[model samples]
Target: MNTTNNIVPAQVIALKKQRVILKTETNEVITVNVSKGKKKDKVFMLTMADLLRSGLWIPVNRTLRQLMRYDWLDTPVKSYAF
Candidate 1:
């Protein structure tokens, strides 16, 4: 996996079953898969924390920020073993 520390501002454009489509400041559209845990098990939605940890994208617009905030509040805590 190619991971980077650089994060770019983006706007959430669409939400799929286990993916999120975002439009970046440069007008680039990207589809990201939502997952969690060390194994990267798939999930149904995206969260701000997820985007941050991804190190690739960040929600920039007001609506997306609100949604990400809601997602952060609603997410359940889980323990992962290394």
Candidate 2:
């Protein structure tokens, strides 16, 4: 199954090693894979884990490199560039 697409699914996988199903507005559901350790030069994810350990899951709403920043497990994909 394709584990790429929605950011939420990736984030869920990043936070918890539990794969989840996310329904996109396009009426498509995607499945994600949650792996251990760091991949894709995962600096943010490593930091996120640290935050989680310190009981901090609220930073996900902030922007990257800002005072507080959180992002999906995978780097956000831009346009498909058809």
Candidate 3:
């Protein structure tokens, strides 16, 4: 939410899910991991494109001070009333 910093988070692309393919900003495509996971074994299948577009790509450090700042809110569900 801070526009002062224009850095993207590493977590945006560092999730533990298998990547089907990777597309570079230059329009080059490559076959990458289908999912991202370290030796510990955890996988996430969430789509991160929206986050990337919003420029929230900054990586978050797992510190109590950082996590405690948030009150654990959820995004409102999108709707179509047409």
lDDT of each prediction vs. the true structure?
0.50, 0.36, 0.31
lDDT agreement of model 3 with the native = 0.31
> Which regions in candidate 3 have their CA more than 4 angstroms from the true location?
1-19, 35-43, 47-82
* Cα lDDT of model 1 by residue, 1-82, tens digit: 3223134467666666555677777886766655545125334243433654464545443332222433434456663234
TM-score of 2: 0.26
Cα-based lDDT at residue 15, candidate 3: 29
Ranking by TM-score: 1, 2, 3
1 or 2, greater by lDDT: 1
Q: Over the stretch 1-82, how does candidate 2's per-residue lDDT look in tens digits?
A: 3422213211222344433223334434344333453434467556556644554323221111111223433445572244
Candidate of highest TM-score = 1
Q: Name model 1 segments beyond 4 Å from true.
A: 1-6, 36-82
| lDDT head-to-head 1 vs 3, winner | 1
TM-score, one value per model: 0.40, 0.26, 0.25
Error of 1 at 31 (Å): 0.9
Worst 10 residues of 1 by lDDT: 61-70
